[model samples]
Target: MTVRIVVDRDKCQGYGQCVFEADDLFGLDESDTCVAAAEVGEDRRADAERAADVCPMQAITVE
Candidate 1:
């Protein structure tokens, strides 16, 4: 199964907690807004989930 990471920009506060959990999958752009990879490999599913869990605004969705 292909893993995907989705961030709800409307709800995100750019706190960067997701970046700490999975820097390779998520990051803060020059504007300090939350940014994430659109998709990830199965091996990195856990990392994606962790990042989702840590998002303070609950703006992340893992699929």
Candidate 2:
């Protein structure tokens, strides 16, 4: 199954914590903003969840 991902740009602080927690499902470009994968595989779900939890601004969401 595919997972939905969302990153709240307003809440994001460019910390890159989410990227470190879930590189396969989240990342930061040169601009240092949180980016989410449109569709993440099941194997990456756990990491994605962790990313969401670790985000200081709670900028990431998975559905």
Candidate 3:
């Protein structure tokens, strides 16, 4: 199984919170924008959820 990930660039503030929570699934580009894994193994679902929870801008979504 895999979890889908989406980061709303318009709403993202480049805070890196999501990256901190899930380094393997999230990252920041040179401009500090949120970059994310399009999909990840189900084993990483909890990490993805945590990243979503910590997103101050509420720009991260996991499904």
Candidate of highest lDDT: 3
Q: Report residue 21 deviation for candidate 3 (angstroms).
A: 0.8
User: Each candidate's TM vs. the true structure?
Assistant: 0.93, 0.86, 0.95
Error of 2 at 16 (Å): 0.8
Highest TM-score scorer = 3
lDDT of 2 by residue, 1-63 (tens): 977888998889999888887777787877888778888787777888889999999988888
* Residue-by-residue lDDT tens digits, candidate 3, 32-58: 899899989999999999999999999
Worst 10 residues of 3 by lDDT: 17-26
Root-mean-square deviation of Cα positions for candidate 1 versus the true structure, in angstroms: 0.8
Cα-lDDT of candidate 1: 0.90
Query: Candidate 1's residue-wise lDDT over 1-63, tens digit each?
Result: 779888999898899999999888998888888889998889999999988898889999999
| Worst ten in a row by lDDT for model 1 | 26-35
**TM-score, model 2 to reference:** 0.86
Tell me which residue pairs clash in candidate 1: none
lDDT of 2 at 25: 72
Which segments of model 2 are wrong by more than 4 Å?
none
lDDT of every model, 2 decimals: 0.90, 0.84, 0.92
Better of 1 and 2 by TM-score: 1
